[model samples]
Target: MRAQRVEDTPGGRLPAVADPLRPFESRSAGVATTERVLFGRLTTEDPVQAVVRRIRTAIGLGILTDGQKLPKEADLARQLGVTAFSLREALSALRDAGLIVTRVGKNGGSYVQRPPASDSIAEEQLTGLTATELRDLGDWRAVLVTYAAWLAAQRASAASSDRLASYAEELADADTAAAARRALGRFHVELAAAAQSMRLTRAELALHEEFDWLVQVLLRDETHRRAIVRTMLEVSATVRAGDAAAAWVAGEQLTAYLVTELTRSRLRLIAAGSAGPGPKRRRAGDIVAELRRISKQTVGILEDIADDVAAGVTMPPTSGELNGVVARSVLPRLGRVEDLVHGVGFMAEVGLLPEAEYWMEWWQRASDGTFDRDYSHQLDPSLDDFYEYGSQDYLTRPRATGRPNAMGPYIDHGGVDDYLVTVSLPVAREGTFLGVICIDIRVAGLERALSPWLARADGTCLVLNAESRVLLSNAVRYNVGDVLPQSSDLSLTDVGWFGWVVARAPEEP
Candidate 1:
């Protein structure tokens, strides 16, 4: 089923998906994420094998968690875009592997049966990797973790900063590897959240997914584990102190130390000559999952923007500037829009959105029906451009229909001077349409957030817009905006209307 225009929010994985209870600190909103991630469309892999891998990835990553019952056979097949027969073959394969149990009749369905320990065969896992690959992954982790901590120090609230410190303590007290891994990964995830950029948060989750299991081999040792927790706490302290430079150094040091430990583990494996392939490169499923995460956080921010507008700028909204709300000489209600502009663009203070000053804009209809436009960005629009609001689909579509509209990957050439996608939803109270809340995400940021995951795919892949235009691609043959060729050689997999990926079909096994 399609999401209603006003209700077009994608099912997301971020904790900030508007939960009143345990918001920002809990796991996802629950099963919708499972549906989004595990039951998403299959890429170009053998369909049966693809289905098996999706379930295994979800269970292994704890997305499905221990003992969680999978949906019914028919339901699972429907979600996966496979037939019932193919679904059964996949489930039977899982049963044979002892990953799931099925007891039918009454009160019965397939239930996950995860092993108590993860695959700690680091020797085998690292044997196939070269020095360059190891160093590259480590460098990526360092850059991602360091910037996350630095930005968190600069932007995190007092409560959240203290929570990071407290979370570090939780890692110190973690008794088991499973508990420790969760704490370790959550520490970075929490740090990303504190930074308040959805793109950063999505990127952190992507980084964690690819290596969380690999890190457990090191965590199995008590000495290495304690060392990790100790350094994490120290970095958390810098973040709590709001010292960005200190946080940067501490976070990098922590990640670098872990990289050293992993390298040593790999070196020992190589010296022993215990050769085996490492885990599979991440797949297109992971890309879909990352997009869902970004979608969820974007929705969270969009909701905040909508709520701010719906709540009214002031008691009467006609009252003169109050609460530091700046009134525009052109219109006072734009002060509300101005407040919204600041509200949405705060996510870019640390460089997620470079020209973030113009990232948010509100276009509203007044009582007399003329449109009033305000930007959160400090720069004023040219008089002619400000007056020529008719061309903005971000405003016109939503204002006319009082619904949602997503526009662009188009260049904001005359405006922000960047490639941007503007996602907007109508601001309404009761039956009235007031305005549209427009949030412009940098296409470059989207590319950076997704590039890490797409690069992990073993083969070439490209994410396409609903119209089959490329939005992101790992293949040089297909750049963003290129129309993907219609060919029997290409396999296009749709993960709902939000996006799709095109890849080459696997050869028969």
Candidate 2:
């Protein structure tokens, strides 16, 4: 009302206007652009919560951290591929939730803020767990899992139900105790994930997260591992037979089994001079002993394979015989494969190999869309039958003898795609060293075990033969019969009743 006077028009009137909704302003660093779709179905009821849930998950994974600055509006908008207006709306909502705080000034930026610690305590309380609450969470887990099993029995698709039965068969056929335990644990997790209850699924996943620390402590007690497996199998059978009530009863029984064994575990830890074994204890020594045992057993399996292969027995090729197999001989035919290579002044975007023995005949496609053909077989090395020997000098040498080197993936080769694993058997003839029997497993139903690790943003795992041909992989473009890392120190062993050596790809030099 006390403002300066305005100039009057011919009619002595002032202009009028409507107010506009301006976007929020915040001082934050820029973020990378990426589109993110929410998990499950996107519905109208909780779209904001859905977005919030994904962001929270990223935070949990350390993708976003406390006090880390957020992206600027323009960058954030670009990264999310959403309009700045939409991004601002989302940020405003987050600010109200206290997940972010804005700052002003040349050096100032928005940062992820921490909530009060009281929220953590409330979550713990809602979980109904505490140090004094119970020494074992198994009792509650037993009830939940048993209920889940019953529901799975009722609602699981026929294929899923059949898969459960098949896993049980595998459990029965497990050559080692370790395999049995792994298979057993896998069955439990899969069953829970397949269950109809989201709560059960989440609880099961939480159980695995908890197991990371607890497994070492618990596995020292063989009885505990055995009891869990036995109980799981029992419950699995009841569920498979469609007896929900019986499955529940079996689940309770499994919990009891765990309870007794956990008591023993507690006793052992107590006798070891503390309520829980830790830095001062002999845990490290025990781990070394276990590793030694595994090595010994793995060597034994290699020896057996070596004997069979050396004798010219019908041992399967590491990735199977691709060249000679007739279409009638197998259910599925060979598929296309792509190669990835790094060369001088160039890196690979994608590569394809022609059916040729000489490296000079092969072609290289560069990331920048350039292609070159080089055919010096000497430089190429055999695309197949290469072993990965550890780094030595200027050249990575291949194994001189036929004997399979002792470190590689555990592939169950020669089986149907639905039942595959990498397996290497050491080979020797008349006590003379030959080569190893190598097999590339087609891991049919166990995609879950492989997919999670293989689908990671970085790193990859693969199974190849002594010739360095690709047999199977968790990542990267691979097809059956593709040439792979030829130099491997891959072998087989039966260290324990259950033993496996997982192969990790070498880092770029």
Candidate 3:
């Protein structure tokens, strides 16, 4: 039957077609014109599996080429008559298959993947098996593989036998752990295929993932892996020579060797642990010190920017300044200076005025404690809580409260040029507020300035005002203008990534 679109009508009823392909044809009294496709002929009744199959088939057929995208999840759900949850499941399965991948950003979305077939075995190994798990896998593999080889000797055709033999002969050239594993896995898969039983073939193919995992964990190096590959190859060759019993004996030998090696490897790891002050420990300490240095430097640069702003005396009003909320004259002097205005814009966009106020205070302190705080929510436009939240204690402290640390926003809104630098003047003179000022440094600039520090550290930085509007960010994936919600009251920290900071220290500045 031909496929047809089900159209919805103005009355919210499904329209019945007399003859969809040839419209205007009338139906007879006794005619059965309901030409719906049968369930068995259609895809899986399980919506998730159906969607997964569609995506896989689309990729396989080149209908969904690499770098191509699919419809958004909600739209897909509506088209497929499935829930968003089902669509997510289908996407997860496709991701696991290495046919699709995801990225997060303003421009980001799911994409078709074209991973090399060469990496499939490695991916399976990395995702599936651990060291201890591999030892157990080795035991099962020894038993089943030996049986399969013995059966192959009794049953293989001439062509299949030759294929198996050819794979075995290639093992001598495998000089690396990865190469040996691949060559050996191919040999086993071929041996199973030689059995001429679909059940056995599928069982082996199905077990390939487990096999890859075991090889990854148990086989530690070229020497250890090469030994296993050599033994397995020999077993298959011996079987092909019409000695089934010899293959079984070879399997037992391999299993014994693995058990002994696994025991020794565990003991060595244990001994290494008991002996303290290893290279990894030193590396970890170095990483921590480097991170601390980066934080201090970032803070320093931010303070310096503030001081610079503070040192430059604001030009005295030659004439009374125009009274207006939208003052175009206050625009930044540098493209980077536009960043501070952008920061305010982002805060306003996210309805985080209180947080914005806090940012202003931090900027002032970093700059040497003298800058104006524009409190009217109307001017800021991003602040949401003008009536509820007040600025009574705002900028009144003589010394730093040490309460609202600039650290959190610095971490949150962090990016390249972000730093804490400050400038100062000897005396409070003339119209100068305090001869000191601060600002949240730009992310891009901070990153470039601290390239040395960043190369050694892997951390995040962000900036938000008192109203919780994200003004700037060093988190690579976070998009500007995302109105991030405040931390949940019930939870100690937020549930989102990096939300832990909010929960871990509710009283954090």
Quickly count the clashes in candidate 1. 1
For model 2, state the Cα shift of residue 318 in Å.
Answer: 88
RMSD of each: 24.4, 25.1, 20.6
Please write out the lDDT profile of model 1 over residues 319-395, one tens digit for every residue: 12211221221133334331112122211111112332223344434445444554523432454444333347766
Q: Report the lDDT of model 1 for residue 328.
A: 27
lDDT of 2 by residue, 1-509 (tens): 22111122222111111100001122111111000221222334544544454444333322344665665656555544555666567667778978778888974555667454232232233223211112335556566667777787676554445445545555556554434433444455556644655556545544532331233344334555555556666776776777778877887786566443443333233233222433433343332233344334434544543343344423322112222221111112111111111111100011111332211112333457343433322323454633221231101111243332332223323212122333333333354322333223233222222232333313344444443444334432333244554465433322232233334554435
Q: What is the alpha-carbon lDDT of model 3 when measured against the actual structure?
A: 0.42
Best by TM-score: 1
Model 1 compared with the native: what TM-score? Answer: 0.42
Cα RMSD of predicted structure 2: 25.1
Q: Scored by CA lDDT, what does every candidate get? A: 0.59, 0.39, 0.42
Best by lDDT: 1
Clash pairs (backbone) in predicted model 1: 357-377
* Regions of candidate 1 where Cα sits further than 4 Å from its true position: 1-63, 71-98, 274-509
Residue 198 lDDT (model 3): 49
State in Å the error of residue 371, model 3: 51
* Better candidate by lDDT, 2 or 3: 3
